[model samples]
Target: MTILLALDDTDSLESRGTGRLARAVADAIAKHYPIWGVTRHQLYVHPSIPYTSHNSCAVIHIDADGGEPLNTALSIAEKTMLDDFVEGSDPGLAGATLDQVAPAVIAFGRDAQQMVLTQERARTLAANLGIWLKGLGGTQDGVIGAMAGLGLAATRNDGRFLQKGTIRSLTGPTPAELLLGAGVDEIMTLDGRRVTEGTIILKEGKAAKACPINGRVVLFVDEQDGKLVAVKRN
Candidate 1:
């Protein structure tokens, strides 16, 4: 079973991004729970939304078989988030197992990406679904994004991984087997051709992101200079 722990709107204009903070939270949770990866979900970028830069949220995938209670992981995440709370930032935290996310939650997530949503609606839906959700501080608008993140992540086809195993450490050209061993679920070309063995070129100083497609992490690449280079898909 996988637990989706989601966070949103926890940074100010002068502070670090939520993805970095999510990594810190994952570090704390890793003490008790096994972290599968962290994903970044982009929300609606309309003028009505109050966002630091890109309206996005971060979700940490945890394996429930790590032998720790959900509350323990939630406490660790809440404490970590509160400790780094930024002024003027409305932080929200939400979590649930994949099974707990119903169709309503998924609909809410899709709606958030296309239209403006309210904290009250998010809270109501969470309450009905029995999901663990809360607003840590400020306007509490982050609850909307946080709850939506859980739904989006539960779809298993949205967002790109912010961290997955040793993916961040891989640079330059790397073998396909090495990438698969580094927690990449699959490696293929942009046209959906599977790559079983080959060298894939990665950009220097940039963390490689594998997108979730049908519940698997897939690394899509494009051929350049006779070498397979990983494509940057938002």
Candidate 2:
């Protein structure tokens, strides 16, 4: 089973973003479970939403064969967040097995992309779905995005990878085979051209930013100056 551990609103403007915190949490959990990837889920951006920057949430995808209880993973994530908790940040956390995510949860994620959502609604839906969700601080409004992040990630079609294998350690031009070995499932051009043998050139100092396509980590590239350059498509 695939497990989705989600976090949101864990940082104020003065502190690191939630995506970084999610990576820290993933690193802590990596001691026990195999991390599939860390994904950044974008939420609705509006005047009403009090976000540190782009109003995005983070999720750590895990393979459930680690033999650890769900609470163990949750406790690790919770401790990681609290260890670097920023004052005035409204942090929310949620976890659910891929199979337990219902249609309503996905709809809620879709809705969050276009409209405002409430904590009560998020909490109620999580309870009904048997998803573990909690607020760490402040308004606890993070519960909304935390649950939404899980729902979006459960779809296996939204968000970009904030952490995927050793993709972050690579820079400059890299072989397609190397990227695949580093947890990239497929390497293709933005126009759907699949590449298997050629090198995917990275733009200067940029690292590979992969997106989930059809439940696989797909790295999209575009031909620029006669070289295939990786594109950030979030």
Q: What is the TM-score of each candidate against the true structure?
A: 0.95, 0.95
TM-score of 1: 0.95
lDDT of each: 0.89, 0.88
The clash numbers for all candidates, in the given order, read 0, 0
Per-residue error (Å), model 1, residue 209: 1.2
lDDT of each residue in 3-97, candidate 2, tens digit only: 88999964688768898899999999989888889999999998988887689999999987423556788999988887777888999999888
lDDT (Cα, tens digit) per residue for candidate 1, span 70-157: 6788889999988888888899999888888899999999998999999899999999989999999999899999999999999989
Q: How does candidate 2 fare on TM-score?
A: 0.95
